[model samples]
Target: MRSVNYARPTPALAIHDLRKSYGDLHALKGVTFGLNRGERLAFLGPNGAGKTTLIRCLAGLTSADHGEIFLAGQPFKSSEARQQIGFVPQEIALYADLTTRQNLEAFGRFHGLRRRVLRDRLAWALRWTGLEDRADDLVGAFSGGMQRRVNLACGVMHEPRILLLDEPTVGVDPQSRQRIFMMLDELSATGTSILLTTHHLDEAEERSDRIVILDQGMVVADGSLDELVEQSVGTQRLVRLRIDRPLSAPIRAGVAEHAASFGATGEEEISTRIDDVSDHLPGLIDLVRRRGYGIADVQVEAPSLHHVFLHLTGYELRD
Candidate 1:
């Protein structure tokens, strides 16, 4: 029998041939990926797509039956590996009776920080998370968003090299979400590699350096935003045109012929996906004029990450 060798660390986080199963259900099917130093990547998928399972395996909260995980160029099973990574779980992990400062102090000490260092780290983390003014307030009295911020502060107080965040903005308000994004942006600037899992498509598009879309324990797509869109949806652009007069049958047929796909709203507006806008727009205008109709407005919409997900998986991400 050939024994599995698991000592290696090439990237900030690397998993090869990772497999995990729970009795009859397969939670992860050989999931593999690499995150480089200072990279911000988003893990995107519907519920039950194994995103949480993968995170647990990396965090050592669960053991993989087969496969290997490496952190910072070393086996992830080691204590050194665990110390190098910080995880903010989907659930709020904090002591309700503890103050914000106390929470950080407790977690910092768990990582074996000295008392003096722990205090300094607690102060800095409170300031960094914008909880300096509320440091003495019991967590039980804090708002949901404030608690979420403190949860993250506790995980990151020691300045770990990599951060794994699982739906950190699930229930937060818009302002709190914005604040968290701003903080993550600052962390990225300081060269902290971050792997976040979220269902917020717009937020992921704006924040992640790369997006990995998973479905049914498989990676359906992975790349930068533009690359994934272009790979999945081709070159067609969505266009919506509003006309002064209702579309005649012949004009509608003409529009369909010029567009790869199109739909009409009785007669006032037409939405279409076309290959070449410059080539198709003039022809569309000419057709409207010939049909005794006038063009009132035209709008073009690019394919978003949502559309790309649908195109690749044939189902909405939420479904």
Candidate 2:
């Protein structure tokens, strides 16, 4: 097995001015981004937003009409650069009739892994994907989640330095999703750069090192969650608190002083939009407590990637 150096500082992937089109219809328009070694970059975009085309271009499945790509500082179009990348598409690519072990073996062989290296990779892939117990079982007999894991395992059998995943956890249970993230985390720890395209906003916010959003075949937004929030919604945070009962005149006045606007109202619930909840919530809670009112619940709403997406792109459905 080849050793991976986690301390390398070079970027694992880079693309500049990538453009693709199908005659009159353009798929990607001047998209540019880079993935640092061992980092997890989440790619997000609306339907028909050039995400699939970009992924296909990076994986060499479809050549970009115009662009420059580099893998580990080498020309991405070269065969040597291709060896450093792995792709796990949204669909399951393994043969259902093949046993789990057989499927992995086939992938390993396809990657040109042989002799002791192939055996070791086969063992490691099964164990890493938690399929050791089902190694002899046919893939057709496994659950959807299990099949997803096998699909992921096959993609990385060659131990590529960079992995690209598209909707890897779609339709899977929470447990399976957690396991897949954990495996990806381990891979990142071992210096594998990852570019993940997922619809799960929470996962992208929590798991990714950086996030990029594309719209209309162009790069609309790219940054961390905090940066994106600041760009989209400024320094605002929503605070929803439920008091024991309706707030009195004095309490309402106090809340009004801190709130820019009010939201949904209930008998005991108060929703206020504040500039920053982290700085004001403690004071508000304390004041409510001093007024003989017990707080039942509190929810802070921050600008999420989903919100930014909707704000940037209209809510109309796309084909």
Model 2, span 192-246: residue lDDT tens = 9999998898899888988899888998888777778788866577787888877
Q: Against the correct fold, how does model 1 do in TM-score?
A: 0.89
| Prediction RMSDs, each to the true structure | 5.8, 4.3
Give the TM-score (vs. native) of candidate 2. Answer: 0.86
Residue pairs with backbone atoms closer than 3 Å in model 1 (clashes)? 9-73, 9-74
What's the lDDT for residue 243 in model 1? 82
Report backbone clashes per prediction. 2, 0
Write the residue-wise lDDT of candidate 1 on 55-78 in tens digits.
888877889878888887677765
